[model samples]
Target: MTNNGNKYLAGAVSFAVFAGVVGPAAAVSWTPPGVTMGVPLGAAFAPGIYVSNLTHYGDGPDKSITADVPAFTWSTGWKVFGASYSAVVIPEVLKVQNKVTSKDFAGIFSPLLIPVSLSWNLGQGFFVSVGEGIYFPFDSDVSFTTSGQTSGWAAETRVAFSYLKDGWIVSANTIYGVTTADDIGRRQPNYFNVDWTVARTFGKWQVGAVGYGAWDLEETVTNAAVGKGHIVGVGGMVGYDFGGSKLLLELTRAVEQGGATNYSRNDTHVWARLTFPIWKPAEPGEEHTALK
Candidate 1:
């Protein structure tokens, strides 16, 4: 099989075995920031843990796949050059199963690292951010030659915009990712992904609708046309904030997909974030104070 075909087959088998694990197509964007629009206050930092269970029912030539992922993330922010900068690190483990091939794959995958991000509050409830990250495979067990895996090293750039005011929030995030060519001289095409959310907050609870779409930006090494690999998803989200922590639940259905793409027809996600102040600026009208 050509590298492009192998990549697609790997995705198909991934969905068939692990029920749609968090692969390249799904991991391009960061989690939604919810209703917050401005930079973090008082030296914000947090260590968060997340667990997601996903099951995918394939269309076309693929079968069912289910997988569970447990992740640990550390996020922190600081002010630099009058703008807010943040960093995040996430490590995850994947446990997956393929019913069609009667095969099971379980191991750690590449960790996601976003070491640099800058944000600005543009006033009038508008905010913007830009960042870059990389997916570097450290686990030898995770390989493109594997039934449920694809390309090794990949890099991504992300941009986001949000408006928040009067208990209403709207945001959009977009990412562009490029994968390195494999040993076989086969390369997966570059891809672009975008996600949008609109939500309203009532007291400590927020409800909203979310949608996402992804498409290839360039032709495959085999000359397959760009845009032939695409997927669209729509879903609802509900969340609650408890001062120092937040919990969110989302359920989405894949409304459209191309045969070459590896995506589930449906999926559910849950996220929990816990934050605490590690440093704080001096109070208004106060003299210079060290972080406390």
Candidate 2:
């Protein structure tokens, strides 16, 4: 809401799915990136319920993956330790197809839960926040997760910061994740991703450059030769507010890649997000800060 009388939400949720293949035909991935970008973390959403649908489609390395992720968020008027609090949950679906044949290969469910998120507005347009997320695999074929099977749980800790003032926004978020071993004792490597966004919102239109870097810190437990996967990409983002709803579109192409088995080093990602409020307090002003 760039032009909503200089207003912005305190915190919300966003998500996507990634499946890459770089050098070899190895394993599959279910890493969802870009959850807390394009907004100030220290701001507050009006105390109410909001929902979003995030879609990610990537076609590369002989395969294509499409993920439609649905999320529900609850913004509270309550505050703890001088920060606004929120919670979110996402239940996602992953569909994979062959690029050449255009036929379905695999599909499964991967879900995420963020029971805690807090944002702190530090005056002068500076905001910071912290959150924790848990990911679960409902099926063994969940995006063909991990080296072999995906029967264990995973945890992620993330932090976000932003500076929003005068229609200008500079924001960044970090994610560090660790996964437990599968049923067969095969563990996916620990991973880290950083999302950086810089945009200017004017007259209900927002445009900016967005980029991210993702790296797997350890090799697959059973594949000693598979080392790790790492890639970086930069792209453009455009957003517009239509009445009470907002839509954001982003496209990024990998500019660097190396040492990956199931990760496509050279890949492109097209992500879209649609967000709107499901319900809100009648006197939003009493529970909402409106803007940071």
Best by lDDT: 2
Which 10 consecutive residues of model 2 have the lowest summed lDDT? 6-15
| Model 2 lDDT per residue over 5-44, tens place | 2111100111112232211222223355454445444455
Residue 179 local lDDT, model 1: 70
Residue 61 miss distance in model 2 (angstroms): 2.7
**What lDDT is obtained when candidate 2 is compared to the true structure?**
0.63
Where in model 1 is the C-alpha error above 4 Å?
1-77, 140-151, 221-227, 264-292
The Cα local distance difference test for each model comes to 0.47, 0.63
TM-score of each: 0.68, 0.82
